[model samples]
Target chain A: MTDKPATPRRRGAARTEELLQVTLDLAVEVGYAGLSIEAVARRAGVGKHTIYRRWSSMAELLLDALSRAWTSDLDYRDTGDVRADLREQFLRSAPALSSPPIGPVYRAVIAEAQSDAALRATLHERFLVTVEQRTLERITLAQSTGELVDGVDLEFAAEVLCGTLYYRALLTDRPIDEAAVDGLLEMFMAAYGAAG
Target chain B: MTDKPATPRRRGAARTEELLQVTLDLAVEVGYAGLSIEAVARRAGVGKHTIYRRWSSMAELLLDALSRAWTSDLDYRDTGDVRADLREQFLRSAPALSSPPIGPVYRAVIAEAQSDAALRATLHERFLVTVEQRTLERITLAQSTGELVDGVDLEFAAEVLCGTLYYRALLTDRPIDEAAVDGLLEMFMAAYGAAG
Candidate 1:
């Protein structure tokens, strides 16, 4: 009886992931505004209720799609050295950051987030807050490890660094390159190096 | 008689500037998709033919508007010093850059540029290419004055600095503060500072 129940539960979980994949593909193809669960269900060959069971609204579905699409969830290593760890983390995320699918999705969601209150709330809850908190944690770790200098305001540094990267992604038509990444890391390191 | 005639031309140009301001305000309020010449005419209380006589198309009108809105036309100054001039230039533009109206218009145009080929062409021709050219000229002035460090690539530096600022406008929820302005200036100067 236990084995029978476990097998069906495993299958249901797998089906949910499959449905999510289909939803993301639709989002990437048509954009956030164009996305509909009906289209997703049709594409996924799943039922409308199946989608509704998991996500109550389109914004929730889109947010889930976005969170799933965030491919850069690497370990935030202390490594007893801030600069080296940052460089590694940035470099590791570079390929994912530059991927074609991710770029358009990110751009669309960001634009949509500006207009949609629910999306804005979901974005803050699921992505933005987590990103800010995690980054602050890493900076704190660096401060504790003496990797960053004394009196270095971790919050400001986090904003500056992430702000620079996100700015590159949104404003300029150029692709985020290796040298630019290296330069950002070096510049921040140099600025905060004296803080410790 | 000719000198008197020139005064009317100047007055006409001033009226055209006012018309463009109305255009930008409309563009920000109703986005590019919803923006129409008829709506602009209604808002400006200018006759439709008046706008049509001056500009052939919506694209042309937008180009004229953008050109008029670019109030900062600073020529690159060579004072045999890069850091000081850069600081001055950046600080001077900070207020203009931080203006609430300009950012929303810039984003609305950018979003429109993504899917509209004609809009993209106008954006590049009227704004981006010219900005890039002028920025290069400024960086060249820095190089010539012997203030910019050797081996600092002019175009990349310009992109990094300008792109970072634009990105800040595009993404961050916070208002543009003096610290960010100073931090950006510091980053650019540090990256390009020559050993004295």
Candidate 2:
């Protein structure tokens, strides 16, 4: 292999990845309230301007870090049984949401968003909206197949599904365990399951 | 009108009320992040020790303030119709949750709880548990009256009911409006309503 200097584009991309990684590490350790660009720059051995140039605020930077690190499969696998599909998806993703790197950081952003409307909008547009829309699509498909009830407002159904898990995860000390998932599904099915 | 100095007990009680009131006012103005015992004392024209003698932490003091100002009737009005009762309660309390004083301050405290486990537990024990339990009681009564489905785990039902409203209130900008409330109740009724 020829030993040559990396291109500016390659160097910039590498730096960006490094910054994001460092941000994730710091978020898990100190949480959102303790995180700042200055701290990230110090940890990454870069100037604050480097981070500011890429992201306007700490929330934006943290959002990118979370989005990059969020590797869980968000899409549902249609197992022909809509209930089974939802159960599988939640069982897979709930742990990631309640655990490190993503969990604490995401909670911090949500907390900060209570005060910052712009961040709230960004979070909804970027993360929550995607999750909600995916849920709606899955349930809509189920409705079409006659697996779910017809002529009902499925958007509210979607919100309840996603929102309940988030509530258990973010607000309460309750576990997003199998029991919780099953209970939620039971209610959903009872409400939306088509007449046999 | 008191022509003489108030008794020590009376004065202490008055001071406590003043401190809690000041705490609520400050919480609404600056949010939990901007709040401190020092700021509350300064604003209330009292020493920090005066505020500290009664409450142990800012969160505790804030909790007291919230409890004091929380005037909404948490109990459901047994209208015999379970859906109507729930709808009435949600419509009544949702405005308090989304509006000034309570809304912003409560959001800030919830946000702070993400980082602090003690605060989280306190919030759960003090506020969420009460709401959840009351909902359980209401639904349990309905179940007994042949309104709700029997033999189902109603605790989970309670969580979903309260949790969805909270999810909408705190996480998303979606208004907890009549349609939203009605949609949620429709699902609940569909799931839990006793088979005719």
By summed lDDT, the worst window of 10 consecutive residues in model 1 chain B runs over B167-176
Q: Please report, in order, the local distance difference test score of every candidate based on alpha carbons.
A: 0.67, 0.87
What are the per-residue Cα lDDT tens digits for candidate 2 across B1-196? Answer: 6788899999999999989899999988888889999999999998889988998888889888887787455769998998999999888888887678898889888888887778987888767888899889999999999999889989999999999999887777778889999999999999999978
TM-scores vs. true structure, each candidate: 0.65, 0.80
Instruction: List candidate 1 segments past 4 Å from native.
Output: A7-16, A41-56, A72-81, A91-98, A194-196, B2-4, B7-19, B25-30, B36-104, B113-196
Interface RMSD for all numbered candidates: 3.9, 1.0
- Residue pairs clashing, model 1: A149-A195, A149-A196, A150-A195, A150-A196, A167-B167
Evaluate candidate 1 by giving its C-alpha RMSD to the native, one decimal.
Answer: 6.1
Best by lDDT: 2
Q: C-alpha displacement of A108 in model 1, angstroms?
A: 1.6
Model 2 lDDT per residue over A89-182, tens place: 9998888875776877898898888877788877776678778888899999999999998899999899999999988887777788999999
The backbone clash count of each candidate, in order, is 5, 0
Mark the 10 consecutive residues where model 2 chain A has the least summed lDDT. A66-75
Put down candidate 1 lDDT per residue, B80-112, tens digits, no spaces: 666656656665664554455665556566666
In candidate 2 chain B, what residue range of length 10 has the lowest lDDT sum? B66-75
Off by over 4 Å in 2: A1-61, B1-22, B34-56
Q: What is the lDDT of residue B135 in candidate 2?
A: 89
